[model samples]
Target: MNVAEVMTTRVVCVDMDDRLTIVKDILDKAPFRHLLVTEDKQLQGIISDRDLLRCLSPFIGTRC
Candidate 1:
């Protein structure tokens, strides 16, 4: 199969300075489970649902 055949054209991206709350909110509503973290239009890293869960687990009740 070709890369284009299975690749997604649209993606959910968030800035490096974006808060975890924002990440959680986006992931909650998004169809996929991963988020692309960028800075200055450059790809920095990727965060998944599980990863976000782990990070947010520490501060459950209060605002992130």
Candidate 2:
């Protein structure tokens, strides 16, 4: 099967300067696992849920 056959059309993207909180929020609410990082309307890179999770603080979302 081709990638287009199963690919999702509704993509989720984040700006380069966007915060982790925003990324986390998007991932938490969306069903997808990856996000396209862009700058000035140009694609810069991709960030997966795993990548965000790895860089997140253990105390994230916790009252410290």
Candidate 3:
């Protein structure tokens, strides 16, 4: 199947300077787990659910 056929039409993104809470909220409600990071209307990077979890996870817990 073509990417257009299966991909979601609704896209969610966050600004480079946006807080982690914003990213977390978007990720929590978004159908997709990934959020595009943008600056000056340019795509800078991407963030995923796991990435957030990793960042939020306690340092006292699993391997670093």
For lDDT, the strongest prediction is: 2
Candidate 2 CA-lDDT value: 0.91
Residue 23's lDDT in candidate 2? 94
Residue-by-residue lDDT tens digits, candidate 1, 1-64: 9999998778989999998999989888878889999999999999988888777586755598
lDDT of each: 0.88, 0.91, 0.87
Candidate 2, run of 10 with poorest lDDT = 53-62
lDDT of each residue in 1-64, candidate 3, tens digit only = 7998988788788999999999999888777889889999999999988888878985634777
**Per-residue CA lDDT of candidate 2, range 1-64, in tens?**
9999999999988999999989999999999999999999999999988888668756655688
**Poorest stretch of ten by lDDT in candidate 1:** 53-62
Q: Which pairs clash in model 3?
A: none
| Ranked candidates, highest lDDT first | 2, 1, 3
RMSD of each: 5.6, 5.0, 2.5
Task: Flag clash pairs in model 1.
Answer: none
Error of 1 at 37 (Å): 0.5
